[model samples]
Target: MHFDTRLFIFIIINIINVRPNFGQYSDDQSYLSSIEFNRGGSLTNLIFSSPHGGFLGANLTLKKLGKSLNNETLTTILWQLPVAGCYNDSLKQCVYTLKDCLQSNNKILSYHPDARCVIDRSSTLSMYLLTKAIAQSFVSHYHPYTILNKLTRQYVDPAEDLPRGTFLLESAIRAYIDYHRLIAIAKEAIRSPSRGLFIEFVFHRNSQTIQLGYGFDPLYPSTMGKPSESTMHELISRSGPSVIIGNNSLGYFLRLNGFEYVIPMEQSQQQRQIRYRLSTYSTRMHADQRFNAILFSYPIERLRKHSIDQEAKRIAKAIEQFIQTNNIKILSSFASSLLSVNRIMRLCVLFLSQSFTMLYISH
Candidate 1:
């Protein structure tokens, strides 16, 4: 039986807050500028649009993709648009020249960027133009603090040279969600929508480190920091003692699967040792350190055999103690958000047990 008490609370609270129908905002979205390629060179056949990866191009791409998906003719123009160098006063062609080149390749084109780690929405394919449309919609609906952003920042690389700090995957996810939603809408428009056309869209990550320069500086952060993404050949995957780890879905899956598996976190495709986190809804819980590496060290397996709720209460107590002693947010609301069903309940119980954190809860 799925005693997902903790899961229930999140389902009731968090999921409802997120607007999956991102495409609804299509009419309002706008863009800042465009990319420019060399005037002389023929545009590359393949296209590689990075919804999230480009550090410099991300903001620009969002505006462009947003405008394109909303208009049928504009979308077609962008698909065929050529470009030279990105962002400058210099003369050139279309900005999406690189993206078109990647798309022209004989084999299926793929994209993955490391710096933008959050829940990858575009990770999944969609029915048609619908996917891209909804992706634009989602980006339009949400915005971060200062009103400049559409999505909230989830991960912050402490080592990044840039001064900005925000969730990397938030905007990407909004667009992805919008894309799929558009696909759904387009199909619904059909006199008889096709079932086979429904494509599964799973959030994922991709890496093309070799394409980018390998030289690294201690002050700069790159995906290569993880030991697994070192070589391109090592990208292959095999079922073994090693298990994927990152956010709550993993913690729950690992708890369900087996304990002996290696606690290695890697993206599905870039199956190297890259520690990426996405849709870690549990991080919203009260315990500050509730969903970090401590998850690997926790004694969850032994706790599972007993009444799941009882054991969850115990784990919550231990986590609560750790939080209090550390003088962290005794009421860290989003940290342990993805904990198991019983775990959330147990956390609330533990919260009541703490005299100091207790005063805030009741008020």
Candidate 2:
């Protein structure tokens, strides 16, 4: 019996063309239940992620060997429960670790007049609201992809490298994996032949300034900096540092909208004294030729209950103005066209392969 070369080629082509559905999560029930993933519209090229804002505790299970699954052991401080209290009456300063909190009769005591823990709840909520506001600011069909971790930082910090982030707990490890998988899926969805932006929302309580990190060193001059040194080096090289510190930059728009504490402005004094330069694992690892990454560090005050709405609107407006000025949306459209050209090329290749196979069979 003669081999059916045409049928084999067709089968190979179909298999090669098969790709994961970028719009949805894996069909596994456990994966679907692991984290929160908000799917974006096909027309939008924006993605936002909140890794530290989750407060849900993971119900962890140990392996048969009684060992944490990962190679790195858990930090000693992480083993102890976190506390929201001062270590002693004299200091009157609240700490994050239980070892630093006041202990009376073997019980950790809260010492601060207003007990508060280092959690990212406010930042998470603010990001969610800001995403909605941004979508509203755009046309009806455009929406951004969002991923939020539900497990608290105590159990999992998806923003960190795996071993430290999960502490080797089985459930926490699964959740961490799910969080990143969702981000990858979202990125794939919007990268219509490679062009998009990723924003990560982080929180800091020490200052009320809004820090925008582009993976630059905190000590580096924001205005007169070298583009090649940044994580968004490609973008900076193409658009110039002006995109970051020029009159039409995000910092400028934010300042124009009454946000006095925006950092990395053109020749701003705060650029030298105060800077976050949060070249986090997420931003460093995810930024590539396909998409540019930025970290938005918001102070707790901006996301407080009384001000979250107004702050979200202000941020949305600034972001909208920045995008318009930079023509980022136009770049996204160009990327879509590139994707179409790629698809047409792939179809032409398949047709040529089929025609060659048919000719061989006829001969």
Candidate 3:
């Protein structure tokens, strides 16, 4: 046999063995179905996601979705700045082949070498956080963050409604459905006579404060307060917030952490309503009302310039302390050991560094 033929056969054999009956898939298809949904470790009642950290453009899919290749939101958020968004042509063109080879096919992989900074919570390192969280929780989804730039009606504004087939819009709807489903699954997991906490991790590129969203509305009329055991509102915020707290105790938590945060809701009723809607959905979504949620948002900016790993360790430590301080029981002994701040920091750093490495390789 020719040398090329032998090499080709070897490649084919390996691909078959690894994929197992999966044959002939486009990069986008492979990514959307498998690479995108990276659930590291086990199904714990914890999830860490960075939806916009994805560098692969799904250019073909986005084109079909009516997104332009040059949308500003896409640029600003994903390919915009030199520090965090997409930076060059290679990342603009999705390349996962090298990434797949590097990871050894055992884990989920996302590749975009030109863009390393997509914003945290909008992180490319969500999978790492998810993997780390699984050591403790019962179920989790660590997600990569990617944006479909031209899906919105306005190129510069992300707040505008996205037209159908727009990538981000599709992702948003999928997430909405997924979160509801996750909540349902988590409810069952939490109810099995096992004490568990549903922890969701998010990224916040615009702020320095790590906001722990518990769904308590301090301004909610006294007559209409969230339930003491409420994790429903908390879950909604975990999925994503309507508004970040700007003032009050929650705001104070940011200050305590040596970070700055804006309390938009504290100052304006309009902002409050905006946030309220962003955090909680209509009662029609029956699943959201039944459970409580515990979520935390980290600042992505810190990852770029500071030893934010120390801060991440601090957050993990705080959670451990919170659990012990309140006598919360975690089911797995493995989880108990993994809950240490040092371990969590290591896992978080590993994922972030790997994701960043994939981007730099393109340069």
Candidate 4:
């Protein structure tokens, strides 16, 4: 009897360990599904959002969305300024191959390499700061302290609708939804426990994505739009009344009925970029010269298409190793070792770096 009980306990542990590896999204394709939540009858709202991704131009009519060749822009770029953004010639021409690859591979590597300075500046690195900004709406308008004007501030926060004057930009939210909707939802025992928990999808792909890869992208839309959490502040601001604090503190989560504020937590989505760096320069994905190459590889577009791209293999190995090692699984289980909104926080760093680059470009 003792041996049988031990074997049953062993099987349960193995099942829990195996769960995260299965049922993930393919990067090549896109789909939609609903996420149900338990608010303990407190009326939890669902705000499907996508932040570090963009799929507005992607089409359902096409199996794999293909971007146009953009060498004209690159070749026209002055050598003095330096070139940016990946310009793939073959993928630009071969739609069929792109489709087939998307179906089989299920991942798109978004290759645009523009620094955050050229983009926007809100970051997700410091959870307290982001939450404080959400609580107070006093952070700089462009985020990570970029864009310090009324127009930019109003552009990010539409004070007319949400009172808190904070919102997750719908575009960014949709992108987050496009990739992570299938990933974030946990299963419900009250509704349909028999289906177990449905896993959220990861929108797998090796295509050119946005370059909010370091503490570089602070002005990326989601960070910018997070200020409008409550509908009441926007109302008070317009009514010619200052927002007053009722209690000693001033943080409130019940500020909106329909906003895309996610529960802040961190995860490692940059495993690909990190591994590529380790191989190319005995480097990591922090600020450096080789970091840009690992980012764009815009320099080596033709080299990536072949079946045996070292970068892809390296990325695959890192992911496989991340899976095989007990460390990541251990991190997932611990609460004290957590970083709030980990993936978004990493992207926040990427966005901030972009802001620095933007200032350089301006100078």
Off by over 4 Å in 1: 1-65, 68-306, 329-363
Top-TM-score candidate index: 2
How much lDDT does each candidate structure score? 0.25, 0.61, 0.35, 0.22
Q: 246, model 4: CA deviation in Å?
A: 47
Question: Between candidates 2 and 3, which one is better according to lDDT?
Answer: 2
Off by over 4 Å in 4: 1-178, 186-212, 217-309, 318-363
Please write out the lDDT profile of model 2 over residues 106-179, one tens digit for every residue.
Answer: 23222231244433332245554554455455553456677766545656678766644554456666787887
Q: Which residue pairs in candidate 2 collide?
A: none
**lDDT string, candidate 3, 157-183, tens digits:** 121123211223334444333433433
For residues 24-80, what per-residue lDDT tens digits would candidate 4 score against the true structure? 233333222111111111111111111111111111123223343431211111112
- Residues 1-363, candidate 1, lDDT per residue (tens digit)? 223466557545644453212222332342221111111001101011111211222222222222222232222211221112232224333232223222312322322233222222221111111223222221222110010122212222111111112212333333443333333343222211111111111122232110111111111235334423221111112211121232222332433433333223333444343343221111111012111112112222233254434433432333233223332222122322432334546555654455445455656
Report the Cα RMSD per candidate. 22.1, 8.4, 18.3, 25.1
Report model 4's TM-score to 2 decimal places.
0.19
TM-score ranking, high to low = 2, 3, 4, 1
Better of 1 and 2 by TM-score: 2
Clashing residue pairs in all predictions, respectively, total 57, 0, 30, 79
Error of 3 at 295 (Å): 3.9
lDDT of 4 at 2: 18
Model 2, residue 29: C-alpha shift (Å): 3.6
